[model samples]
Target: MYTREETIRRMNGLGRAGAPFFFVISHDLEHNLLFERKDGGQGRSAAFSLPLGERGGLRDCPPLPEQIRFDPVPCPLSRYAAAFSSVRAHLLRGDSYLLNLCVATPVKTNLTLPHLFRFARAPYRMLLGPDASVSGVHGRACACFSPEPFVRVRGREIATFPMKGTADAATPEARRWLEEDEKENRESATIVDLMRNDLSMVASRVRVKRYRYISPVETRGGTILQCSSEICGALPENWPSRLGEIMMALLPAGSVTGAPKEATCRAIAEAEDMERGFYTGIFGFFNGRDLDSAVAIRFMEEDGANLVYKSGGGITVMSRMEEEYREAIAKVYVPFDL
Candidate 1:
C-alpha cells in the first residue's frame, strides 16, 4: 500500500514530466496500481484504453473462438432480497439518503480472461496483470467493461458523466418509463449535485452541462437504456502539478458511493459483508496532458478456478426490494456485440 503523499508525489511528477502512464485506484483508496506506459511496464500490471466502436489496438489480442461458450450464474434472488431488505431498513431510519448496493455473482464460462478481454464490448475496457491475468496485490485477476466515466481531464476543463438509472429496452415503454420514473429522476439528480460539489473542491465554475440524457447500450440479453448527466468544471492553472491531490479529493466516485458519501460508504460495508477490492474502483490513462478513466463496473474477477461478476444499482428510500434485486441481477450479462 502506498501512502497518500507518495501517490500524490509520483502522479504529480509523472504528469509534470509529460510521461504517459496508467493508474488503478481502489474503492476505498487503500490499494493502488501504477505503471509506466513503456514496454507495458513491469510485473503483474497491464493497462490499456479501447474506445467504443473501435478495435484497432487489439491486433495482438485475438477474439474468443466461436466454440467457447459463455454462461453467467447470478446470485439467488432469495439471498439478494435479504441484502436489499437490510439496505432499505437503513434508508428508512435515515442512515443514508442513497447507497449503491452491489453483489458478486459466480459465472461459468469456457473462455479465459484474455479471451474475454478481446470480445467484451464497451467504450471503456481494461485488463490488468501478466498473461492477461487480473491477479494483483490481492491475488485476484479481474477485467472491467464499464460504461461509466469517473472523470476526464483535458487542459483546463474537467468533466464527469454520472450514470444512475437503467431499464431493459426490449420493453416497448422503456424510454417513456425511464424518462417518467420519479424514483430514477431523483436518484440521478442527487448524484449530479454530489458530483458538482466534488468538482467545486479544486475547480471553479462547476456546472451541470447536461441532464437526464438517455444512452442505449446493446447487451447480449437486450438493449438497456442508461440515464446519465454531464457535469463540468474549470481547473486551476496548476492542475497538472497537483494531479494526485486533485484525484484524492474526488475519489470513490459519487455515483457509486451515493450522496453524503462517507456515511453511505460505511452503510454499504455493513450491508455488503464482502470486500469490494477493485470492483467499483477507478482506472484510466494519463498522457501527461489529458487523462481519461472509468468506474470499474460490469466487472468480473478470477477467484481460483471460478469467475465472479460484480453488479449493482442505486438504492434510495423510495426503492422497492424486488425491483432493486432484479436490477442487480439483470446487470450480470456481458454486453457482447449483437
Candidate 2:
C-alpha cells in the first residue's frame, strides 16, 4: 500500500528500467500499489490473470472443482431508487450529463476467491493475497474478474475501449436495439467523448476509431450484450518513461466515472455514500514494452463471513428508475459457465 506519490515514483522508475510489473489503484485515487515482476508476475500480495494475446488467453489457472455455484441476493428496488433519484437530481441540476451508480449486493456462493481465480471466465482477473488485511489489496478477501478494459498502450499508440449501455442479449433484435436506442446511444457517445478528451490531455490526434461496437458478456444468469467504442491517441515516443503521468491523467477511467469527471465523481460520492474501494479502479500489467489494463468492475469481496458482489450502471437525464435498477441487479452474476 503506497501513497500516490510513491506509486508514481515507483512506476516511473520501472518504466525507466523497462521492468515489467503489475499495479492497482482504487476509485478515490487513494490506494495504489505497484509490484515489480517477481518470478514471472507473482507479486507478494496477489496472483494475476490477464489477457495478453489477440484471443482472451491467460497464464495457466487451476482447474475448477465440480458443481460450480453462484446465487446473488436481489437488491431491494427501493434502495436503488433512492440512489437513482439522488443522481438524477444532480443531472437535472446540470451537474453532469452522466453518472455511474453502483451497489453492493450480498451473494450466496459456494465459491472462494481461489475458486473464482481458477474458473471465472473473464479476460482480466485477479486474486488478492494471503488474506484481505494484506495492505494495498482490499481489506477483505476479494477478487475481480472484469470484462471491460480501461486502456491499452503499444509503442506510441494508446487506445481505450469504453463500455457502456447494456441490453439483454436474449431479447429479439437486441444488438440493433442497443445501437438505435437513443438513451443507450447517448450514454455510449458521452463516454466516448470523455475518453477522447482524456487521452488528448497527454496525446495527439485522438479519435474514435470504433463506435458502438457490440461485445457479448456471458454470466451464470444469462447473456448480456454490452456496447463499447475504441478511442485511440498518439503518445510521445518517450511515453513509457512518463507512464505515471499518463496513467494519472487518464484514470479512474471515463467509462466508469462519467463525463465532466471531477464533478461527476463528487456527485457519485454524495449519491453512492460509500467507498467504492477498488470496484471501479484500474489495474494493469506493463510487460516492459507494451501495457494493458482493465477497469475493476464485475467485482466481489468477502465481508466477514459473507460474499458481496458490487455492480452498477450509468444514469442519465433520460434514464428510468425501474430500468436502471434492473440493470444494476442484472450485473451481479458471477462469470461462470452453466
The local distance difference test score of each candidate is 0.81, 0.82
In model 2, the clashing pairs are none
lDDT of 1 by residue, 159-259 (tens): 99999899999999999998999999999989999999999998999999999999999887789999999999999888888888899899889899897
Going through the candidates in order, what is the number of backbone clashes in each?
3, 0
Q: Which 10 consecutive positions of candidate 1 have the poorest summed lDDT? A: 50-59
For candidate 1, the TM-score is 0.93
**What is every candidate's alpha-carbon RMSD to the true fold?**
2.5, 2.7
Candidate 2 residues lying further than 4 Å off, grouped into runs, are 39-45, 53-65, 132-138
User: Top lDDT: which candidate number?
Assistant: 2
